[model samples]
Target chain A: MFQPSMQNIYRYFIISLLITVAVNFSAAQNKTAGSDKSSEVKWWNGFLVKMDVVSPVVTGFSDSEHFGMEGSVQFNLKRKIFPVYEIGFGGADKLSSNAIRFNTNGVFQRIGVDFGLLKQSNDKELINNMLTGGVRLGWSNFSYDLTNLSLSDDYWGGSQTLNFEGRSTTKTWYEIVVGIQVQVYKNLYMGWNIRNRHFFKEDTSGNIVPWYIPGYGKSGSSNTGFNYTIGYHF
Target chain B: MKRESGNNDYFNFKNLFNILKNFLHNNFIKSTVFIWITAVFFFSTSCIVSDEVCRKEKNSRLKVGFYTAILNSSTGNYTLSTLSIDSLTVNGVDSLGNIMDSVLYNNSKNLSSIKLPLNKFSNESKFIIRFNDSIQDTLTVFHTNYDQYLSFECGIIRNHLIDTVLITNHFVDSVKIQEHNVSTIDAEHLQIFHN
Candidate 1:
């Protein structure tokens, strides 16, 4: 009886120790590798550069567009504040139901700052993730082509078919963005953001409004946008 | 942790309420009320505005004026003089060789000018016009149809350009083409001269 009791205690002790070790190993691997780096890093740390892989992939499946690409670079400040710069190019060759043709290709840019919203505490587990809110100022300059447009004078005896080519304009807009980034691998992150964009002015001239704006989805006074990005940290 | 007190803070809810009360008591409320009023403004706009009340006829029709050719003694040329028909009737034909309805001006008396609509689907418009129940003429217009997109609200409109006008001469002597294009604007298109 004494020998059996001693074996049971020994077995229970080994099992508890193994369970503790396994739990600790997973927790450490899933969380940040080191907690000291997050607090010790001063402002003006290395930059985190990201590329938007979703935009190009989505444009490939777009019916109206030929292709599109977007990328961004952000500077980390105390791991709490970030200044971001984004650039993109998009174009579309679309034909309307009435045989009105619209073609355009343009470059767009956005500048913004993001604020980190993750709660900070001394005793919590170290997780390299962030919830961010940001505001952006965006602009695009482009030239477009409109063809096969017909105009007639009803009482007059003449009709004209007109084509407008290389009509250029500059558009300015603003966006409010919210997003989340999670560290998937060591020094690598995957993130997505939703943005609400509003344009300050619209081109409502005699000509038809542009069917598509470079960074904005459609040519409207307001729009919503989404981006999925993969990033690397230095 | 001690800074979370409710009464001693400038950013507290009480302070915000007081600030809003003060703002409402000032002229700033005028602009706010104006914005609210405009926010409630409603417009009955649509993608297509149906033809409702008949104010003025559509300008898509061709206008014709009747005239009599008089022998000029000085230039030895026939000049046009305005003439009115005793009784006039016009009918339009459709694609299935069916006589569509008689146009707006049917069995009219003493008409100086007549308006006729062209075919919307086909390139040719055929019309049978009778004058005084004794003289009848068939007018055929060959043209091209152009679909014009005015705007989203206005929708699409069909415009036509006349290539040629052929008519069977009964009591009519000659025909003159004044305008070759027909649209929503009103203008004289052709003049028919009587013998």
Candidate 2:
């Protein structure tokens, strides 16, 4: 009887230890969950810096080269999606008009979100993994200074000097970015994004014709591009 | 005797090959280092920094200059300096400098603008033209024959800040017409009377 009682007591002690660990883990998860609901920029433990090669396929410029680069910074709102701000720079437009060169080299700044859609299997016996997916919508305000740009009768064969300054305008655009970021290697993530831009409206305007956009060159409609990025979090 | 001599000859050839191999190996290593050094020197010298002045030709003329301000946004009324004149030239700016479309200034030529050097210029010191009515005007500026472009200097004095503008009136001309809309204000409108 003494031996049986002792065995039963030992089993109870082991079960109680297990319950304590489970409760502690659950409390920790709840604490993290509470924090995630507070801010759009605070879902993650740290931030991510991403670089992507961009190809803008604005409609008409299909046969031409419209390669570009985007640099973005994201702050997490939940385990997956985070608000992001991006700036882009690249070579000039591949197509130049009689007066405008496709020299599209400039800086583009953007603000949006990176949506994380895939959840990784937790290595720890206690943690359960979750997956999330979302989209980013924001406005893009960007423009190039035409003062440094020269418009010539040069393309169509005219030597007449063009006259226009202070004649330039500041243009605005809007974008919808959709991305899938997944957990891969210990806090190291990989994501792919495709963004669409609807660019129109000018703050000031004059005589010169606006340059064509990549993917939708001069179609003056919507434009789209894709990005592949690798990031690590702290 | 012939077979043994042939074998001896083969050994000699192998020795020669080994010597040449060692020589080639050392030479290639040296050559690679030399090429790398040459590349470093050539690439380092490629970029050269030089300086050029960015000032345009009109900056020298102190020409085609004027200071006007908006006093009443609702009325679209403005005021010009007492010595408001038209048409200056500079090798510095647009072919057609500043020109008013319909407003009237008594003297269009022999342009003698009042050279009032401003002592100070601040957001508060608004030297404005208080027009009695709304007028659409463009300040026509040009450089004088000896001038290139204009410069405006503003300074703060003891109590009054002054502004000075340099303009050249050698090449351009100014004509002010008071009517922005001919249907509302006709050509007879003028600013000929100022005390």
Candidate 3:
């Protein structure tokens, strides 16, 4: 019989389940405070709240094999340039080799700018429509748990091979996310974003070939797996 | 009574050892085949159950009756498996590098439609499929079988980049038989969890 690792699988299942429940509950509870904006402020100066859910096209082992949550709030400092803070989770599916499930995923918190496309109108004929684009740079702690993965060769292929059935943690991960949003209603809007996550630094052949870092169209490029969420302005 | 019981235990151990030896020598691939059969059977079972959704007979081997690319262009129609000392054609290699000849392949078929056979494999063993060095040495494909799944693992090893693997099935059209990176995975990590 094969060596069964049922215990570890069960533990992983529980962890994933808990995270799913927590995120869903958090979104529901913050609906009022983060859903729609009240009509108390002027068009030029207002706060916008946004929340989104992400389901990946490629996942499992290579990435966190589950749908994750991410949301943010931005209090418009001005009409042209608005500074905002955001936080969320991300996972990678592409790999350089099969030996390692080259996964780099974690939570991120960033502060960036949101540029509005159209000028705020004084007329109320249409519910205020606007176009927005933004970029954010944040820090993330990437952790790879190898406890459930194993690599063996022969009868003597012992634990010296750095089997993945062990868990590992790697912090100091940085990612950049840029996206565009279109506001159709007063505060309700539709938006899409692409996030790029790199290992921050690469250490290959002692020359540091950017193993921990990623480039354009290079490794760890999150193409188009973002979500569409409804936002309300306050 | 104790002596008799000890003798019985001794014989039981001897019998188990003999059975194991036989399994290793004659049925060398017994474990491997069992795992492979189970994986094939499982995916086949799922397709069978999902018949009401999309009606199709339970195909033991996915028919590649129609293939688009025949000329790999770079590698002259033939390559060698560096790890296993076998000649692997463009389609896929087996335990021995002989171009996988299938019962479905028709000699009279044109090159355009000359589809390779199904990559029949099991979980009892893992296979490494090496490509001709002419194209690029950055890619390596792996085959690993399990009780309920047959995974094809592929990865690119770049000198100045982060490495990654894609573990999935042969059918590139559907999202069902998905693949993942297996390097960092151990025996403990495989699971089917709920949302």
Candidate 4:
């Protein structure tokens, strides 16, 4: 006799749910685009506040060792340019595969400007959508504790363990961003962006490198980040 | 009435198909695709994490030069010159006063220079050196070992500073410390004089 397994049933259920949501979302988007009307211009309408919901959600869903949150405020100029300030808090308690452990929490901030690239048309002047390319300068200051770093000699018969506590450092970096924003409601927007981050200064003189940075993902030669944001217009 | 409804449905399908085609050709979609492709290419090409291996054998060993007191006819005195030791054997001594056999050389015939590794964890290294002259000398090296962290891949290496060297006068008449800092860099650290 043929039978469906529990895992198969769950997978089928999720697939059907995703299809239904996609269809409904497309229909809502068409209706909103057809009915949206232009509002009277005001100076305060250019200001916005946004929260990066994806970063917090991703950090929450991750396994033990990491947590993060980020938010930003931006000003639109001439509907062609945007100036933004973003702030975030992050922490990690990780034991590396080699048994080296590190624990830290810190704050990071970034200031940036975004340029709109969407072509303007008289017919779609009422639509509030943007395709943006931007650049950011980021900074973070943090203290960390590294423990259980073991050292052993191959030829000589001896071993030692080392620990460093409250080591403090400051870092500066820059990021190039590419993203899009769409007006999902009268005064609400949903957007997503991808950023390429490069470090301006990193300390490698010590034997250990910082495994994770606050705003940055993994501390490496370079890093990449993705953010999904929800915003409200004033 | 049914035929007319069928034709209307076909016209709506053709209009939807044209809309999809126009959306595919939109500038925003094209730009997004370009950026994503560039990002993927850059990520795949640059995201390489490599573990560095320790290459230089520095500070790991101590070098000693063998010198003989040869008579110089021009100066009318014995001067130091290179001497080759034959049938040399070196052994280490344990903390309990037991001889740990062949810590450096095992009845090997050394020509001129030999590199000997110091004990990493211990502050003292004791060696019994024997030569073909049927003479045995006890050489004791007093040192302090400092922990040094290399990279993650290389782990920890110990650096040594020689406090003092004590040697029994047998075949070796005297000892001189030329360099006290012991590291992996190959340089003569001591001079053993044979008369």
Candidate 5:
């Protein structure tokens, strides 16, 4: 049923090709410029603590059906590899158009590692800038409530109202992330990233699946999310 | 020309820092931030709320088709063929022989199959079938009903499993069960064989 036009495919291909060429060129330049200075950075170059500023603002601007806030601590290794630990809390109070209401709130955690694509420079001005790609494994455990659910027998001439409360579930998912971070001021950094997230398991039939999973957006197989973060470097 | 490389590095870092400070103060960074904010705003507002309605059939009914047995000459075996009735009237009844108010088929002409709703509250459903308004037969179905949760939008529906069938031998010869499991999905569950 879904068909991609040749023009669109060509356009996407061209864009991706351009991006690849640009990144390769930049990395090549950095490689030549920082070949001798790369050893100056230490293996453990401290850590950065960041807080997401996009989720709260975006959810507030939207219908407010969902809201989430998250923070992360990423340890820098030789200004190249980053091992990160992130935690967040998310909640939703959504009422469907048909009067079915769902409510939930819980905490979620993620552990991951990122690889910097840009070679490190000894120059302090360029030392705090990075182009990074990473993968994350996230887990959450939460309970939800669904109310005002009704079933009607039109032919048999009867209707029954059903409600499920305190139904708990555990969910695990993975994310592929790409982002850029730059030092805006002394010891202060600003960055943004886009994530493509996918769940490890699907909801089985006849199960009362939650309308929204904490930190995972809507209840579905995959979701795309964006985050803009501000961090302080130690 | 022969200065220390460390001093050259420090001078270059200072110059680069000043250039970065000037770039941050320029309108370029401000414009980029504005574009990023606009993009985020659009992305946040673009989420379309799902308006999915319950599209699956929720009614659980028993499907009965009329058939006639014909003998195959070469194989000497009886083969079943579909039979259409001229006129048929079907309605449910209680155990006391009192007909319910609902009529499933009211003089349906040239009907080969009919669907009847089973009772969710009772274990047995009785239906009176009047053929051509002249001959009548009573068909009884014994089934067990269970609840199945479909989804939040569709809620729940009662499904049935057929155990046995009892019918009066008036104008109907014999009855056969084709399929036993009955839910919202439409399928032929019973067959009525007549001459």
Candidate 6:
């Protein structure tokens, strides 16, 4: 079993926090040098439509083992809090070294909120940039097929082949996400985020569990993922 | 005053835009993106190759240990201790009293314990044990077997629960069931005691 160490989690969080502080400090310096327009507080700001650009490249390199593509809509509120809804399709076709084959494909969803860590500034350029940290709850319900499973009785002189088709299961996990987004052009942004995902429950003994989860990467106690995204702010 | 300030703010915004455009064109951002993409590719590849392999034991067998009862002189009590047999031969037998072709132990010498495989298709297993090629005993074991799924790589294994054991008291004195459940775990399941 591959277990993510607590020390690594702590180190990731510390690095994210330091990056947030550094970006915030730089934004503050720029704000002091720019014009001082009266801060306008709007309860509802427009949302951004974002698409992940990294998944396809990864899938292509994975040699048909893993495939995933996802998009998200994030609503900006008072330029501080962001509520997000993400949806995606993911699948896996894996052949074990022992010749057992597993196949599955399904849709997954995630709902979360992000808090902007930088201080609000009136500069038009600075207002569009954000350093955020968030939490997400993700879920997927899917079915899988496993074949070429063979069991032999060496002493009894017999062998049996077993195939399990359409084994259904539901999985849920939580993520700690941290990212920085910067405006590249008018209403266009480019960003990258790192996620630390943890599963709520694991498959019990004697049950056939999935080798790969839809939104969650490989099925394990925990995993780490990275996403590069391009977005258009409306 | 408001109009002049508005014009000045517009000029500052244009200057900031130009600075950002130059920043994006710099080599730093370009290299960062390239490095990130490379890292992501390697990370995904590493995940794909790191598949779990089945390394656990898969064979299920019954372990029998030889023991003897000895009188403790000072305590005036009898204690059971391990016994090593001088010569032993064991073979499987059918219900019709015909010996099977497989020989579990072929005249083995100086063994304190021996492991034997039970029948997966039948409810009972019979074995003939010959001591020094002279004194012989027949041991019959009644067991119920079930399949247990271990993992994808390991597949399934048959586990047995011993219901009863019958042994003819020839060279063997008595038998006791130490552990009834038998799976891949290597442990003593039965103890055969001799005088």
Best by DockQ: 6
Candidate 1 per-residue C-alpha lDDT over B97-192 given as tens digits, one digit per residue, 9 for 90 to 100: 666654646789999889887876678887788899788888888889766544423334576899999988997877888999887778989999
* Segments of candidate 1 deviating more than 4 angstroms: A1-41, A64-66, A121-127, A152-159, B1-195
Q: For candidate 4, write residues B122-165 as lDDT tens digits.
A: 88887788877379998889999876555443445677899999
lDDT of 2 by residue, A1-234 (tens): 456542354355345434433443454466578775423433445777776633443212435434555677877654445677777654334323323233333445666554332222234521112222233343323332232332122111222222223333334566555444544667666656544456555323223434433222232344444566677665
Clashing residue pairs in candidate 5, if any? none
User: How displaced is residue B34 in candidate 4, in Å?
Assistant: 4.7
Per-residue lDDT of candidate 6, residues A1-234 (tens digit)? 856655365466657556555555556567657855424668798999999987887899889798999999999998878999989999999888778888999999999998776556566756777657888999999998888877776655667777889998889999878776878999898888877788888778766778888999888777778888999999
What total of clashing residue pairs does each candidate reach? 5, 62, 36, 5, 0, 0
lDDT tens digits, residue span A5-70, model 5: 433543463455345435545555666686765566689988999999988986787577888999
Model 4: residues with Cα > 4 Å off, grouped in runs = A1-45, A53-62, A116-134, A152-158, A176-194, A207-209, B1-26, B37-59, B63-88, B95-97, B109-115, B131-139, B151-156, B163-195
Give the lDDT of residue B56 in candidate 2.
22
Best by lDDT: 6
Scored against the native two-chain complex, candidate 3 gets a DockQ of 0.03
lDDT measured at residue A213 in model 5 versus the true structure, 0 to 100 = 86
lDDT of 4 by residue, A85-181 (tens): 9999987887765677878889999999987644332345334677677789999998888778875655446777888888887888998776778
Compared with the true structure, all predictions reach lDDT values of: 0.69, 0.37, 0.37, 0.72, 0.79, 0.81
TM-score evaluated only on chain B, model 3: 0.20
Lowest-scoring 10 consecutive residues by lDDT in candidate 1 chain A?
Answer: A118-127
Q: Could you give candidate 5's per-residue lDDT for residues B1-195 as a string of tens digits?
A: 556888798567556644653464343347457646754663554355353587777888899999999999999999989999999999888767789887889999999999998877678889999999999999999999787766656766788899999989899999999999888778999999998
Please give the range of 10 consecutive residues that has the lowest summed lDDT in model 5 chain A.
A5-14
Candidate 3 residue A155 Cα shift, in angstroms, is: 13
Docking class of 5: incorrect
TM-score of the second chain for every model: 0.66, 0.19, 0.20, 0.73, 0.76, 0.79
Model 2 / residue A226 / CA error / Å: 1.2
